[model samples]
Structure formats: C-alpha cells, structure tokens
Target: MQKESVIKVEHITKTFGLTKALTDVSLEIGYGEIRGLIGENGSGKSTLASMIVGTGHPDSGEMWYRGEKHNPKNMLESKEKKINILIQENGTINGLTVAENMFLGKESTFSKSGNVNKRRLIEEGSKALARIGAGHINAADRIEKLSFEDRKLVEVAVAMYNEPEVLFVDETTTALSQKGRELIYKLMDEMREAGKTIVFISHDMAELERMCDSISVLRDGHFVGTLQKEEITQDTLKRMMIGRELTGDYYRGDYEMSYQEEVVLEVDNVTWGETVQDISFQLHKGEILGLGGLTECGMHELCKIIFGAIKPDSGSVHLTDGTKITSPSSAIKSKIAYMPKDRDLESLFLATSIKDNIVMASMDKIKKGFFIPPRAEKELADEHAGKLEVKMQNTSQYVRELSGGNKQKVVVAKWMANGSEILLMDCPTRGIDIGVKAAIYRLMEQLKKEGKSIIMVSEEMPELLGMSDRIIVMKDGKQTGEFERSEVLSEHDLIHAML
Candidate 1:
C-alpha cells in the first residue's frame, strides 16, 4: 500500500506579470521523507516551495495539509501551523542581534507586560544554536558581525527551533561549507526519523542523490516527473531537468596546467583583521587560479582585497604596470572586476533594471561627452545579455525578477561589458544549476584563451580541482598549500591542504 501524504497540492498555477512561473503543478510529500526538488533556474522549484510555505500563493490551486484544506495567508501563519522555511538568500535582518532575529515574530514568548526580556531571549537563542550544533555563535552579538556561514546557521536555528511538521529548505546548503552541510543533513535525518517531512530544493545533484528518498524534477514551470530512490542518477536527473542529454563533461576536460607566465596581478602580505593573514599570490595572464578553503577561511576575504573592496591592513595589491588598487573605482579603472559571494546583497542592485546594472560598470566607456546615450546603453546591455544567454523579456526588466542563475549572469555581464582584464569570482556558481554552470565554465575557458586572468575562490573542492591551472588552499586565515594542475591531482589532495 502507498504511504499517506502529509501535504498535497492540486492543479497549482502561478503567474508573475507576463512570466508564467508554474502551471498545473501538483505533488504530494510524504511523512518521514526527504523529498529532493530539482530543477534548472527559473524552473518553478522555488515558486512551488514558496507557495507551500505561504511566502507566495498560486492563482489557481488547492492545497491540503494533514487532509485539510490549507492556504496560509503569510509565513507567520504557516509557522503557526508548524511549517517553516529557510530561504535561498540570507533571511536574517541586518541591524538585529542574533537573539532578536531568532525570536523575531514571537516576541510575546518572552514579553513581560510590555517589555521584552533580552536576557531570557539570549538564553533561549543560545540553546537554539546549540541544538543545531552551532553553539560557537554568540546570541548577544550583532547579526551583521557574523560571517555569511554563521548567519545561515542562525536561519537554520530559527527554522528548526519550532520543530515543524514540514520544513522547506530552499537551496540553503549552497551557502554552507561541509560542516554546515553535515549539520543540516543530520537534522534532516533526525526529522525523518521523527516522521516529519523535509522538502529540499537544491541544484547539487550529488547531494540530492545522497540525502533524498525520492527526487522530483521540474522544467519550465511544469512537473516533469519524480524518480524513485533506485532510479536516481546524475545523468538521469540532468536529462529530466534540461529536457536533453548533457553532452560533455560538466567541468573543464583538460588536466594540463597551461597558462601564460606573464604576471598580471599580485597580492603580497595581505592581512585583514584576523580573517586574512599574510596571503600572497601572483595571478598570471591567461590563468584560472583557484583558491580553496572552508567558508570561514580567508580566501573570500582575499578576493575582496584583490578587488579593493576591502583594504588590507598590512599589505598591497597591484598590477604589472605598478598601478596600486586602493578602492573599487581604482580596481575598475585598472580593468579589474569582482563577483562577490553574496550576489543579492554585495554584487547586485536588486531594485534596478538589467540594462542599468549591465551598463553601470561601463559608464565611463560608453559615455559620450559626459552623457551616456540611451541607445548606446541599450546596445551595450543587449549585446552582453545576448552573449551570456540571459533569459529575460528585455534588458529593461528589473533584476529582482530574474532567477538566481540569471542574476549571476547579470553580474558577469556587467564585468564583461566593463572590459575587465582581471576577474575575481568568489563562489561564482553557488546555487546555480548544471546548465548555467556549464555556460560559466565555457565563458571562463574563453576568457582564459583571450588572456584574461581569473582568481576563483570556492568552497567546493571538485570545482577547484576541475577548473584551476594552479590551486592554493587556506585554513584559519592562512595559506597552507599550493598545487599545480595535473591529471593525477584529486580532491583528496585539496582536502588535505584545506584542513
């Protein structure tokens, strides 16, 4: 006999302006199961999850939870009914303390008359963090002071604190390192053991195959199919997602360490407030130099220093021509571009149009006598958007409407439009689908062929091994090892250095 579903939806359809996000999509999530939701970007995976968690609603559909008609008016209502979600982006508000963010909506739980007991709030928040194996985070600290990984853990603590019957983890793992990923995976396993349901949305195929009981595929706002546990494979899921076979390897095929020896950019003795320590490296003219480390390690900070987003306390970043990059403007003037790990917060102007963002970086280049022509801006945006294969109505569309993968494309598009010679990409492919990953990899190869240097900072070991001509590893704000690309190199070697 088939198992009873904990939640069910029927004939769900949602539309956002001219974009049809979902159409006649229906699925049942079973109790005590981890259901992997896989799809390419803009494939309605997040849309469906949002609807279920009450962050969004369908124009036409019916949903039932525990055999009752269920339609939550907002996220708070869903949380009241033991349903919660950890979103793809950082969910914690900036300017709030860790305890304040943890108990944001449920202030009455610690309210006395009209005043909130801050002490009790911190006490409970610390316990919540401990429950998720994150006791190292201080509840009294400001949320903004924490690292991106720690803020993610705070979100996880909030989501799991209520002991929800249903939890939607929307690409949350993409922001995490191996330790954080394991914490979440262990929590999911415990939830399964307790007969709860977890709707996991992710672009990582290997993670889905390992953690899910069954996998569901969505394609262009439609439910393609679901694979039973025995039927799930990377190849099968990829075919279902893009509706075609992935013809070549997902990463770069060459193993030979090939790049021009001309030193284009150099970082020497860079240190930043204990997060980065005495890191030095030379980026070559046609090289893909990989920086691998744990999320808390200094590689991400090093990328920022290289791009002049963060000034090192005791070191310098300069070019072959002796141009010292002191700030972002100087970096841009030196033909350097940076793609930060936190795309929505750090990299993009979310409230603006795609054309504006693409042309923003190239304003000096596209300007005509102190005034950029509208036609010139449109032409430049359209050219790079087309080159990047950005799926959109037009360049005039707001960037907030684009999917995660496409938003990343816009970040790349802006730099490409700027004619940057040096690229600093920190976690470039985080939370992106395989199709888009392949596209970005191809772009990297093309850039390398054209003698544009790249510094790739990533938490994924496989990506570092696959793309780097030279790999540098870091642990606890210090460089531990470096390796040249060879056919014999493996993830094991990188992991050794990272630890």
Candidate 2:
C-alpha cells in the first residue's frame, strides 16, 4: 500500500535563459521515508531540490505540502513551513564564528534590548553540534578554521537545528569521511523513526542502495523512473541515470603494479606541525600512489606539502633533477599540477569564465609576447575542455553556473592544458557522477601509459583500491600500512590500518 504523500510536485518546468533545466516533472515523497534522487550532472536534480527548498522557483508548476498549496518566495518562508535543505556547495559564510554561521539571519532570537547574547548563542550552537554527534567542534571558533569536512558537518547541524518536517541532503556525503557519513546515516535513521522525511541526492549508487527506501532517476530534465528498495542495484540505477546500458568494470581492470623505476619526485622526511610527522614517499614514472586515512589523519595536508602549497617545517620536496619545490609558482614551473580536495575554493576560480579558468595555468603556452591572444586562449581551453567532455553551453559561460561534476572537469582540464608531467590529485572524483568518474579514471590510465606520474589522495577506500598501484595508509599523522596492487587486497585491510 502507498503511504500518503507529504510532498508533491506537478508539471514542474524551469529554464535558465536558453537552457531548459526541468520540464513537466512530477514526483511524490512519502512521510517517514528516504527518497533517493539520482542523475547525471545538469540533469535537474539539484534544480528540483532548490525549488522545493525555496532557493529557486518553477516557471510553471504546482507544489503541495501535506495536501496544501505550497509556494514559498524564499528559504525563510520554507523554514517557517518546517522544510530545510543542506546545499551542495559550501554554505557557511567566511570570517564568521561557527555559532554565528549556525544562527545566521536568525540572530534576533538571541537578542534582547537591541543587543545579542553571544554566550547564549555559542551555548545553543554547542547543543546543536552535540545533537549531530559532532561535539568536538568548538562553536566559538571561526568557520574558516575548520577543515572542509568539519565545515560540512556544521552545515548539517544548521539544517537540523530547527527540527524540520522534511530535510533535503544534496551531494553532501561526497565531502565527508567514514565517521561523518555514519553520523549522517544515524541522523537520517532517527528522523525516519520519528516520522520525518528525507530527500537524499547523491551520485554514489552504492550509498543510495544502502540508505534509500526508494530511488528516483532523472535524465536531461525529465523524470525517468523510481525504483523500490528491492529493485535498486548499481547497474539498474546507472542505466536509468544515463539512459543506457553501462557495461564493463567502472574502474581499471588489472591488478598489476605497472610503473617505471625512474623517480620523478621525492618527499624526504617531510614534517608539518602536528598533523604530518616524518612522512616520506617517492613518485615513480607512470605510477598512481594512493594516500588513504581517516578525516584527521593528515593525508590532505600531505598533498598540499607535496604540491608546495604548504611548506614543510623540517623537510623538503624536490624533483628528480634536484629542483626544490617551495611554492605554488615553483611547483607549476616544474611541470607539477595539483587538483586540491576542495575544488571550489582551492582549485577553481568560480567567478571567471570557463575559457579563462581552463587557460589560467597555461598562460605561457597561450600568450603571444606580452599579450594573451584571445584566439590562442580560446583554442587551448576548447581543446582540453572538449577532451574532458565538460558539458557547457560555450567556453564563454561562467564556471560558477556549471554543475558540480562539470566544475570538477574544468579543474582537470586546466591541468591537462598545462602539460604537467606529475599530477597531485586529491579526491579527483569527489562529488562527480558515475559517467564523469569513468572519464576521469580513463584519463588517469591514459596519463599513466604516457609516463606521467600521479599521487591520488582520497577518503574513498574503493577508489584507492581500484586505482592505485601502491596504497599508503595513515593514522594519527603517521603511516600505518602500505600495500601493493593485488587481487587479494580488500577494504578490510585498509580499514584495519586506518582504525
């Protein structure tokens, strides 16, 4: 028997200038149920969610909340209706305290006599953090001081603090670690038990299969279908999402540790503060060295150290030719590229055009004397962006308008345009759909075949196992285990080292 619908949309149509975002879409989400939203990048999943949360509006549609006509002008109105959302990108304001971000636009609650009670605000923020199993975070600290993972948790606390009747999680787990993901899972389970609703959006098919009561798919602004929990599988979900049969292994096929013996780059006893301690590693020609660990295990800091974004206090990073890498400019000059874990903040200039961002790192190659010829820059950007299959209306489109997966593609395209011989990819496929993930993996394999070295740092165990020629596991700022590619290697082996 079908449960009563808590939320419903009919004949929803939305457009952004010349692009049609959604068309004639309709769906129903039941109370006390987890509904999964799956689609390729630009398939209108986020668009639909944005409309429901009042961050956007439909060109023509009717929405009902518990059988009432629901048309909210803004998120504040939706909040009054007890509906909330955890957005995909970073939502917290910089230069603001955790408590301030948690209670943004609602500070009047803590005000008396035209003055705010800062102490009360922090105390309430602490309670909110504790409710989501994240009491370790200091509510008084600045939001910028927290790591990307912790900041994401703060967004979760913000979304849940009001105890909404409906919660929308859009591509949130991609930024989280195992512990953080477990916390979200526990929270969703608790909400369901309490008769609340969850609308989960993720590109990870396995995650949806495990967490969702039913799965819905969208393709090119149209609703494809929905599958009950019993009918959900990785293959079926992929088919519905991409509108085709996806064959063969999504990752590399062989277990062979293939690479050359020539050392391309070396990290010699690198130590950085309390997070990274006496870590050393070598990148060989045509190698994928995987770095894995828990959220606080310092793997991310190590990537920055190797890329010269953060200088090591007691050690050095050098190329095979004895060139010291001590800054980003030097690293880029040395033919080294870094795709940071935080793509929007570290790796991309979101406010710029796609063509400009793609050609930013290759200025030398695209310039003519003292001027950058527009034709040369456009050609360079167009070639690489096309190679990556980045879905954009044109190279002139602003990168900030593109979807998350497509934004990641722009980041990769920039490095490829630079002809960088050694790549430092930290969570290269983070927040990307299956189709884009496959493209990236294929690109990595091709780079390897061309003798370009890569160091892949990821929190996803399956990615490390599937893509790395050698895996290095870290715990508490130290290397705990190392494994070579083999068919017998399992996630358990990696988890044991991480724990």
Candidate 3:
C-alpha cells in the first residue's frame, strides 16, 4: 500500500537576485517517510527545505500540506500547523539562558500579567533537554557557555520540543559527534514509527543510505530524480549531483609526501586553560600536518592558538624566521591564514557581497592611497571566485545567500587572495558535499606543491589519512600519538588514539 502524501510541492521556483536557486521543482513527501535530499553546494536542497519550513517563500508556484494550501505566514504559523525546521547553523542567541533560547517566540503559556514565569520556563526546557537525551545541558545556564557540539544538541531539542508532525533536518549531523548523531537517528526512527514525516538533507551519503527510505536528487535547483531505497547508490547520486561522471580521486593522489626540512610555523609549548595542555607542534614548509581528535579534544582551541585568535598562556607561535604571532593581525601580516570551522558566523560577513568577502584579506594590496580601487577589488575577487568555481549569478551576491559548499569556497578564496604561506584549516570539509570536498582536497594538494604549509584540523579520519604528510592524534587536550602517512597505518590505530 502506498503511504499518503503529507506534503506536496508543485512547480516551485525560487530566485536569489539573478541566481536561480530553484526552478520548476516538484515533489511530494509521504507520511512516516524519511526523504533524503542530496546535491552539491548551491543545488537548492536547503532552499526547498527553507521554503517548506516557512523561513522563506518561493517566487512562483504553490505548495500544499495535508491536502490544504500551505503558505505559512511565519515560523510560528508553520509550527502551529505542526511543521518545524532544524536549521543548519546554531540558531539560538548567545548570552540568553538555555531555557529562554529554547522557548523563544512562544512565551504565551509561560506569561502571567505581562511577566514570564522564569521557573516554569526552565522546568519545561529541562524536560525538553532530557527528552532529547541532552540532559547534560543546564536549562538555567547561558547559551554561550555551552560548547559548539552541545549547543547543536540544544538546537535539536528545540526543534523537537513541539512534537512536530513533519520535521526538516537540514545538514545538522555534520556538526555533531557520534553519540549526538546517534541520538538524532534514534529520534528520527521513533518519529517514523509514530507516523511523522521527515525531509532530511545531508551531505553524509552513508547516513542518508541508512536512514532514508526515498532519496531525491537536485542539481542546480532542478529536480533530477527520486530513487527508492533499493535504487540508491553513491555513484548514481554523485552522477546526478554533478551531471557527469565523477573522477575517482577525491583526495590527494596516493604518493609518499616529502616534507621540507624547514619548519614554517612553530607552536612551542603552547598552553591554554584546560582546553589545551602544553601543546606543541611544528608546521613544516610544504607539509600538510593533520590534527585528529574527538569532539572537544582541544584541536579547535589549538588551531585558534596557532592563528593567534586566542592567547596562549605560556608559549609562543612564530615563523621560523623569528617573527612572533601574538595576534591575528600579526599572523595575517606574516602570510598566515586561518579557516575557521564555523564558516557562517566566524569566517563570513553574511550581509556583504561575495566580492567584498573575497577581497577582504587583500584590502591593503588593492588600496589606492588608503582607498581600494573598485575595479581592482572586483577583478581580484572574480579571479579567486572563478578559481574556486563558486556557483553564483554575480560576485555582488551576498554570501548569506550561497549554499554550504559554495560558502566554504568563499572562505578558501579569502585566504588564497591573501597568498598566505601557512594555512590553518579547521574542519575544511565539514557539512559539504563530495564535489566541493574534492575541489578543496585538490586545492590543498596544489598548495603543498607550491611549497605552502597547511595545518589541517579535522575529526574526519579518512581525510586525515588521505591528505596528511603526518598525523597528530589528540585525546583529552594532549597529543596521544603521531603517525607519518603510510598505507600500513590502520584506522583502528587512529581511533584508539582519539579515544
């Protein structure tokens, strides 16, 4: 028996300025189904999800939910209809208490005489957290106090708090660790059992295969095809995503990478409050040094120390020529680049144009008497954006409008424009699809060939083994094991070190 269609989108079209994000896309999501949506960056998966979740509206066409017109006026209206979204980024505001963050926009029940009952809000928030298997988080604690991974859990809790009939999970697992991801998967399964619909968007193909019943492919905002569980395969999906045969080399070619004798950057006895304890590492010229660790193992903190984004308590980071990196400005001036994990919040100015973002690091170089030449800035930005193959209508498009993968390309473009000698990349491929991931891997290899040093901090072990000249494994904020890349190095060995 065919399951009933719970939500239906008919010939929906959406445009961002001149960029056609979606065109004549049509689909129907069945009740109790986990529908997987896959595409490269800028492929319209998130755009479609956002439209359905009432974050935005399509420029043309109509959608229906439960056989009724479903043009939601606002997020609150969508939730009232039992439709909810878990957005890709951390949506909660900082400085607010966890309870306040969770119950934002819906305080009517907790309100009395124009006053919010703070205790009742906290109690309900605590229950929600516990229900989502995130009881570790304190409802009364400030949202900013939670770690990035924990905050993601809170986002999930908020989305599920209303017991939504149709849930949209948008590239969320990429931000979570194994346990957190497992908890979400468990919830999805339970929701399916309860006859709820899930519109799942993910770059993790493996997870999608395991969790989704029907898989849909979108390429450049057009609905290509939808495959059932038995019909879905990685190669088939990849082909649909790029509209071509994908070359096998997603990482650097299998070769023995030789490191230069010269150390480009040195983190000598760097120490930070509990996060990093007496960490020391050398980023050699032309070497791709990999930092592998579990979530919150302090690799992120160490990257910030190297970039001079955070001050180390007792040690110094320096170029081999003896220039100190005591601040981000000094590091950038010294031809050092840092790509943060949080691309949207940390790496990008969302409201600004792509050209502006690309030219940000090269402001001094493009300046004409303390002012930048508009033409030169645009030309330089265009060159880098083209090199990265960022899919957009124009360089003037706001970065906030681009997809997850394209935004990452912009981040890389910024550093490339600066022509940095040493690059600090943390989770460079996080929340991105295979095509963009391949491009970044190729770029990293090319940079190494150009004699530039790269310090790659990642939780993805395959990427570490695939691209690194030497891998440093961390556990509990300390280096556990170091391995020079070799075919004989087992993943089990790396996992042991991370644990």
Candidate 3 segments whose C-alpha is farther than 4 A from its true place: 1-3
Assess each prediction's global lDDT (C-alpha) against the native. Answer: 0.92, 0.92, 0.90
Clashes per model (N, Cα, C within 3 A): 0, 0, 0
Full candidate order by TM-score, most accurate first: 3, 2, 1
Which 10-residue span in candidate 1 carries the lowest summed lDDT? 1-10
Please state the error at residue 486 of candidate 3 in Å: 1.5
Residue-level lDDT tens digits of model 3 in 1-499: 1239898998999988777899999988899999999899888999898888888899999999998888987778899999998877878899799999999878888999989999999999999999989999999999999977788888889889889999999998888888889999999999999999888999998899999999999998899999999998888888999999896568776657677898888888888988888888888889999999998899998999898999988889998889999989999999999999988879999999999999999998889898789999999999999999999888998888888989999999999999999999999999998988998999998999899999999988888998999999988889899999887887898999988
lDDT of 1 by residue, 373-483 (tens): 999999999999999999888999999889899999999999999999999999999999999999999999999999999999988888898899999999999999999
Better of 2 and 3 by lDDT: 2
Please report how far candidate 2 places residue 85 from its true position, in Å: 0.4
Model 1 regions lying over 4 Å from their true place: 1-3
What are the runs in model 2 whose C-alpha is more than 4 Å off? 1-3
lDDT of model number 2: 0.92
Write model 2 residue lDDT over 29-56, tens digit each, in one string: 9999999998999999999998998989
